[model samples]
Target chain A: MQLKNIFQEGAIAAHFIAESIAKHATKTEIGGHNIFLGQVRADDIDGKKVTAIEYTSHVDMALEKMHEIREAIFAKYPLTCMHVHHSLGVIKAGEICLFVFTSSKHRKAAIDACAECVERIKAELPIWGKEIFEGDGYQWKVNN
Target chain B: MSIEIIFFGQLADKTGCSNVVVDNPGSIDALSMVMKMQYPNLATAKFVIAVNNKIVFDNEPIEENAKLAFMPPFSGG
Candidate 1:
């Protein structure tokens, strides 16, 4: 199976997300849709504050893993569509880093599938985030 | 024979470079020994090894021109 590329060069734009939803309007069968957006938080470390997050990933491996997760989620849920996008490079605080959208005929399937996809992406993808502080310092982010 | 090894996240910082080409060390265990010797900081670092993009828990034989990667725990959203 050809792997779907999910990584975007920078933060996900709000207009791009709006366009995605607008395109899905043609699929009238979808009764419900769930969307999840991940934003960079301005976390304080000691006296320094987080200014941005730099994301990196093993591209080939991450795409392969994402494909597996997509297949599994499709098999587990009755969904009409699913889409995911993750930011690469540096994303500033308050910017969108990740976006997950799922649509299904029923609200329950869309809601559950969207949640599962986000959780699996966080745990499985070979991606890392470096939190850049106000001062030239940085720290690796740990998923909680 | 040589293998291509890539490091990710903090492992890359510790290694001073993102990738290296090393002589095939025969087995994953032996490869680890060689890597730790070359990059002593890795001796205390925690990471998982992936041979050709597949994570292997047990020591596995290294093939010629294999692509290996050292990855820390994932923190993607």
Candidate 2:
């Protein structure tokens, strides 16, 4: 299962994508798992509160990047399975912003690979998001 | 030649248009043409350009009618 986005619930996404990765490892003797769940934190700008985040991307380009990432991770890590998902549209504060899951025969490798994958995506992907403030205002959050 | 240059997300908002066709380069990279076209002021916007989902950096000889899309830094999960 492959899906990405910052959804309504950060807790739900942590469980969901983790479950997806676990299911793929049932047939293997894999042991540990690694996951990174990105959350939207409350940002105060000039007394304006960020109530939610609206994300967007070049769909075709993003999917292609994911595909390449999947291949890259496989070549770089010893893993039974991996998954990445990011939310699009409005997501409230303390909500799930991004999810990355990886499973391997051991915990160390899995954790390392997951971190690498997440870092690579953040540094290279073509996605964008804007923080929606409390009073009909917003700001784009790029590589920042 | 004449590949379409489409900006998405924040870039589009700044450029005021979703897409445009850049003048064909005799033999150069898409990035050069992109710099020459709209938003030349954004000459240093560190971003990637994709030709139909494939990254294009060098002059690599792309299709004349390719749908090129430029994207700024990704902030997705």
Candidate 3:
């Protein structure tokens, strides 16, 4: 399986997601597929609402870490395939920023692997996000 | 010995520049000390140090010409 770079310049579009799913239809052994999408929320901070999120990363390190995460997940789970994508530039509120797709021969492995992939990506990746408020003010996002 | 320092995320903004070269080559702690003095705002900022793309603790010794990255807490989803 070839691992993609995973970083897109903007939001991950619906057509891209559809095409990803379409690619897997030929694999007859796969019984289940699970997906996780992370959308930019319009959070209200200090009476101001967030307009968008500008993402940046230590690109080389992030890709390296993601590759490690993928390898670990594949080793631990009985999965047929997995894909991860994240947006790098400004993504407006309500747009998708992150996507994780996992397929397995059984439902449990697909579901469990997809969730674990999302959690690991959030904790292990070297990506940063700035919340751009409506009036041009911004704050750094901290993941809880 | 000189080392290359790269800052990411909010730390880069606080430092006002993304990359710099420092003459002091020692442990990560020593580099932090120099950075704190040069960029006072970084003194209060929270971050982690990575040597050659791998995260390392403050006590980790930095080799000459090493590529060090200062990264803030990750917020990616």
Candidate 4:
């Protein structure tokens, strides 16, 4: 079976998030929803300002790892649904690079699951970002 | 005994190429030695080795046509 791919080519659109939330309306069992958006930050380094971030990943490994994470979160939380989308290629500062949404019968489960999912995605996914500076320089971004 | 080694993230930058096919060097330690010799710049880089998508630490014997991946610290969200 094919695993669900969470990658998008560029910046995630706001309407995509809206549509995702809208789609969950029919699922009456879910009483609470939590969302997390990761925006590309224009960080200044050594007098250079970051203008964008170009993301890349090992597709096969990332999907496999994501599947494992998805299963684990379901096993641990009473979540009704979970969705993750991360952007590849260049995403300008102030644009959304990641969107994580979780739904549950209670507020706490969705809230906690969303948080944990974000943390794990940052720490575990086999993805990298190249920070493009405003002028001509670039550097690999490291998560803190 | 051909083993494919794939490089990811900063390790790819250090290696200049993403993937290399090498003669199987018997064990993980031997493969590391061979890789360091072939790509001297990789000697100073920090990375973890994964065999067939699973991270491995022990000097396990590698079978023919195994896929190896060298990954640097993950920085994705």
DockQ for each of the predicted structures, in order? 0.93, 0.65, 0.90, 0.86
| TM-score of predicted structure 1 | 0.98
Model 4 stretches with alpha carbons more than 4 Å out: none
Sort the candidates on DockQ, descending order.
1, 3, 4, 2
Q: How good is the docking of model 4, by CAPRI class?
A: high
| Best candidate according to lDDT | 1
Q: Give a tens-digit lDDT track for model 4, residues B37-58.
A: 9999899988889888888879
| Clash pairs, model 1 backbone | none
| lDDT-based ranking | 1, 4, 3, 2
lDDT of 1 by residue, B44-66 (tens): 99899998878889998988878
lDDT of 4: 0.93
lDDT of 3 by residue, B1-77 (tens): 77788899999889999999889657877788999999999999999988888998559877777778999999997
Per-residue lDDT for A3-119 in model 1, tens only? 899999999999999999999989999999999999999999898899999999998999998999999999999999999999999999999999999999999999999999999
Cα miss at A62, model 1 (Å)?
Answer: 0.3
DockQ of 1: 0.93
lDDT tens per residue, model 2, B9-63: 7777767788876666534454555554657645666666676778766767666
lDDT of each: 0.95, 0.73, 0.92, 0.93
By how many angstroms RMSD does model 1 differ from the true structure? 0.8
RMSD (Cα, Å) for all candidates, in order, is: 0.8, 3.8, 1.6, 1.0
Indicate the DockQ of the complex predicted as candidate 2. 0.65
